[model samples]
Target: MKNTILILFITLLSVSCKKEPQYLVKIEGKQLPISAEIASDKTIEDFILPYKEKVEAEMNTVLSYTPKDLVRIDGKLESSLGNLMADLCFERANPVFNSRTGKNIDFAMLNFGGIRAGITKGDIKTINAFNLMPFENSLVVVEMTAEKVTELAKYLIAQNKAHPISKQLNLIVEANEYNLTIHNLPLDDSKTYFVLTSDYLQNGGDNMVFFKDPVKLFKLDYKVRNSIIDYFTEIDTIKVELDGRFTKEN
Candidate 1:
């Protein structure tokens, strides 16, 4: 009996000291479909219903109207959508920048790819602004010398894409040479120009390295999306046209 008890105790101790087996599960099976019959939790649905309803209401609120469709397309010097967005950026941020720095924003530039969606010929809603500028990029003023501005123009010419540029600047691209005018005047290499752009571009987004080394940077603390929304709210109708702000010649 003593031997039996000792043996049992030793066995139990050895079993307890044994290491647990490791598992290397190789799941090799096709994905199974989730059936629609699965019932949702009523508690979760109740909790989310109010927030969903509020969001839908706000998103569906009409802000403005567009008579024509504005779209961003490739291989074009300019687009209606690009013109509208850049103009709005300038219109909205210029006053704030002037108020803070007492300097006028010479022009505004936005990446073509940044304007995510097109505006249809119908009512523009708050959700449209959200969809157009989905990123949280803030407007910032970059103080650049005329030389830097020249570099920017050259960059635009080389890119040959539909980059959004305000009316204050014009570019004519020829075979090997490019002509750039700011405010209907030739670029003065001695002057410094304040330019409004998103923080993303100022930080070298979209290969806009010229915006990197600025003489000064002013953070407007204004989101680009909010600017669009505000502009839409202030205007009853939105109008934009392609007036050869950017042109190409052989």
Candidate 2:
């Protein structure tokens, strides 16, 4: 009996000592290595490349299908705003998903830098999507307010060309100053707005701290890129016609 118990105990110990598998992310360039993962194993050869290939494949699937991108707003301001929204979305699939699991989400936001590619009159592809936003960014949603929207607009104008905004925004470059209409809109303090954004901004990485204001802050379970991908896919048909409704410029 004693011998059997000892054997069982040894087996349990060995099992516990075994390492589980995981995906690993390695960052070089800095002195200290930045290592992380969404998987279990940490070895570069064992995990990172394959996982990356899988993600890339997934991204390519939808990206390859998009024919062309379009922006149709009533005025230059609205048009610019629409362009910005679309550009930011092109950065990723912008999926709205479950919050607890860091899944794709509904209604997301993208920054202008992500819109790296200009849609020409032709078929769009994964390469095009990659060209638009090459970074390994995820999607996120925030709870904001109309007041916060005003702040965002003011921040954009105040920063002028320096502001990292979506293509949806328009600034009058010649005047050396940009005007904002957000201030003109009345902001109710208690009203909350669901603002979907890229994961980069939520973690204080984007310097858009106003998004984190205590009163206006509500975190949502969503990834902007993934959700955006879902949206595009759901649309089924590709339609590109010039509405000529740029809202921001006018």
Candidate 3:
């Protein structure tokens, strides 16, 4: 009987000691605005000065030169910057892909918004590559079916934006129908086409669903920004133009 009473007492004690859940009765938010009125901390600035200087020096290093400004808004259905981005990525990524799998990428595609900034008509610096593609998107090649390729063309025509496409592709949108040629040949339904693009697009980013669920995926493990940097380093001048890669008929 004594042991039973002790057990009951312990159980009661445990129940009584249990903490109740805390509830939030109200929520208050405060606005903190950053302005020049706030004084800089000298100690903090001194500590960061070396790193800042190093980064600035590295970013300011010249890579290549551009005779004219490369802007994404320069053309309809395609842009000079878009052309450069797609072509350079292909040029850089194809060799790597071919070396590994012995297969050549049929074409390259990238979203318009991927080009973050324009290259001014002057010396191209390392910072220009960073400014152009700030994301850590990697290069990936997807083998897509003819149906998926058609969907891709439809999406491009519907959006009617300057999505970056390599010179290998010739997309002509005419009313309800469109004509697409890869490497100057029409898309074959019996065979899959390999397309070079960033991992972001391969995962259906920016509503590019056609890129998702491809027949085969080849990851190059190369970053798009690095490709741009490498391309700039190798080339003395950057010249890109819209050579009727994509067109629309009225």
Candidate 4:
């Protein structure tokens, strides 16, 4: 009887000491305004100065020169800046895609709004590439069917914006109909075509739904801004032209 009482007391004591689960009941937030009133940390600032100077020097390094301004708003159906962006991306990304897949990208496309800045007639610096493409969008190749290609053409026609397309494609809009040729050849419905685009567009960004759910997807692991920088580094002078790659009948 004594031992039973002792065992019962120990059980009760153990139960009483058990911890209950705690939960977050409420969350309060306070805004700390960053203003001149707040003191700067001199140690941190001093440590970062060298890195900042190095980065600025690299960004200002001259890559190439442009004789004329490359602006996105310069053309109605196609812009000089857009032409250069698309052409350089195609040129840089094609070899990478070809080496992996043994096939070439039919063309490259980018949104008109993607060109964030313009290049003035002067020495081009590394910062120009970053200013032109401010996003971290990477290159991707989507193998699309003829039906999707038609949808792409229709989307461009309806928008009537100067969305960038590589020189490999010629898109002409007449009335409600459009004509498209890839690499100087008519688009063949019997075969699938590979198109180079940013990963963002391939995921249906900027209302470009035709690039989503492609027949096949190939990621080149290359960023668009990097491609622009590389192309600029290779060439001493940059040239751009609309060249009738895309046109609309009046």
In terms of TM-score, the best-performing candidate is 4
Residue-level lDDT of model 1, residues 1-250, one tens digit each, is 9999999999999999999998988867798777878888899999999999999999999999999887987338899889889999999999999898777999999998898998889999999999999999999999999989988998888888999999999998888877889999999988999999999999999999999989999999999999999999999998788899999986
lDDT of 3 by residue, 1-250 (tens): 9999999999999999999999999999999899999999999999999999999999999999999999999899999999999999999999999999999999999999899999999999999999999999999999999999989988998899999999999999888788999998998989899999999989989999999988999999999999999999999998887899999988
- In model 4, which runs have C-alpha deviations exceeding 4 angstroms? 1-20
What's model 4's overall lDDT? 0.94
lDDT of 4 by residue, 75-169 (tens): 99899999999999999999999999899989999999899999999999999999999899999999999999989988888898999999999
Error of 4 at 115 (Å): 1.6
For each candidate, the alpha-carbon lDDT, in order, equals 0.92, 0.48, 0.95, 0.94
What's the alpha carbon RMSD for model 3? 3.9
> Could you give the candidate ranking by TM-score, starting with the highest?
4, 3, 1, 2
Candidate 1 regions exceeding 4 Å error are 1-35
> By TM-score, how accurate is candidate 1?
0.86
Residues 1-250 of candidate 2: C-alpha lDDT, one tens digit per residue: 9999999999999999999997768856757555674455557667678888887776566432335444322232333434434444533433222335354322334444444445444454445445555666665556666577667656555543222334333334225444432213334566654555666776665566656753433344334434345445555545533232222242
Of the two candidates 1 and 2, the one with more favorable TM-score, higher being better, is 1
Model 3, residue 150: distance off in Å is 1.6
Error of 2 at 59 (Å): 7.2
